[model samples]
Target: MHLFIRATDAGAPPYLYAGPMTYRGHEGERPMRILWDLAHPLPADVFHYAKVNTG
Candidate 1:
């Protein structure tokens, strides 16, 4: 399956879906459970993003 993610680190690449995950509370609140698929990075450069001069 294909996926996308807003990666913070440029070196770290995205990956495929693994399993479910849960977020624990800090002090005394109920834990939050979130189920989602992981993102996978593409091998090729799909879009050529560059700064353009519109002067």
Candidate 2:
């Protein structure tokens, strides 16, 4: 799955988010989580999400 992130005044680049994330199979499908705070990285159990260029 892919997520669209907006450009911020912060020095970080604008990009799409992805992750080798592992979520609880709630119902049947896994969910995606976006990590906006780059300074403080989130774990894989939560979602090691990152940004990538789409356009």
Candidate 3:
């Protein structure tokens, strides 16, 4: 897994994480259980980012 992560990470080094982790909470008094979402970090949208003049 480490190798795979490294390869993917190299492919796109700007993103913090490439996946999302989710889990369901226990029953609550409101008759609805809460779902938890955990993620490492948000990635930058290069499509909408300003272009730099490297020239």
Candidate 4:
């Protein structure tokens, strides 16, 4: 499935298209941490932004 990510909902920030991803695995029932192998690698800037903002 395709993955889309955005840092925030404010204004009209466009969602970064993460491309199609394949399900790798998952853990836990409550939290459900999942692993996906992305078809295309995310750009360094986008990856950094997502990590910083989300983390």
Candidate 5:
């Protein structure tokens, strides 16, 4: 999938977010989890995650 992110201070979405991420978060260090779920659904027991980190 093609991902595009922009720098902003207003803090709202409809855009990919960026931050100092923690490993404790449910989706790990990935920023594409939500979109991935919508674009591609998988079984609850199945693990198929993807990541695309950029500034």
Candidate 6:
């Protein structure tokens, strides 16, 4: 399935296209974390921003 991602909603940032992804697996019950394998890699800037902001 296709994936879209944005860093925040403060200014209603437009979602960046993360390309298609494949279901990888998941864990946990309460939160139900899910994993996906991206079909294509994200750009350097987008990857860095997402990583830093998300963590």
Off by over 4 Å in 1: 1-29, 41-55
Better of 3 and 4 by lDDT: 4
Better of 4 and 5 by lDDT: 4
TM-score for each model: 0.18, 0.22, 0.23, 0.79, 0.17, 0.81
lDDT over C-alpha atoms for residue 23 of model 1: 42
lDDT of 6 by residue, 1-55 (tens): 9989876757766788889999999999999999999999999988988888879
Off by over 4 Å in 2: 1-7, 16-18, 27-55
For candidate 2, write residues 1-55 as lDDT tens digits: 3334544537866753533343333343366543332433444533423223232
Which pairs of residues clash in candidate 5, taking residues 3 or more apart in a chain or in different chains? Answer: none
Which 10-residue window in model 2 sums to the lowest lDDT?
Answer: 46-55
lDDT per prediction? 0.35, 0.41, 0.41, 0.86, 0.35, 0.88
After TM-score superposition, what is the CA distance of residue 25 in candidate 3 from its true location, in Å? 2.1
Model 3 misplaced regions, further than 4 Å: 1-19, 41-55
Cα lDDT for residue 14, model 2? 71
Q: In model 5, which range of ten residues has the least summed lDDT?
A: 46-55
Candidate that would win on TM-score: 6
Clashing pairs in 2: none
> Once model 4 is optimally superposed onto the true structure by TM-score, how far is the C-alpha of residue 55 displaced, in angstroms?
2.0
Using lDDT as the measure, the top candidate is 6
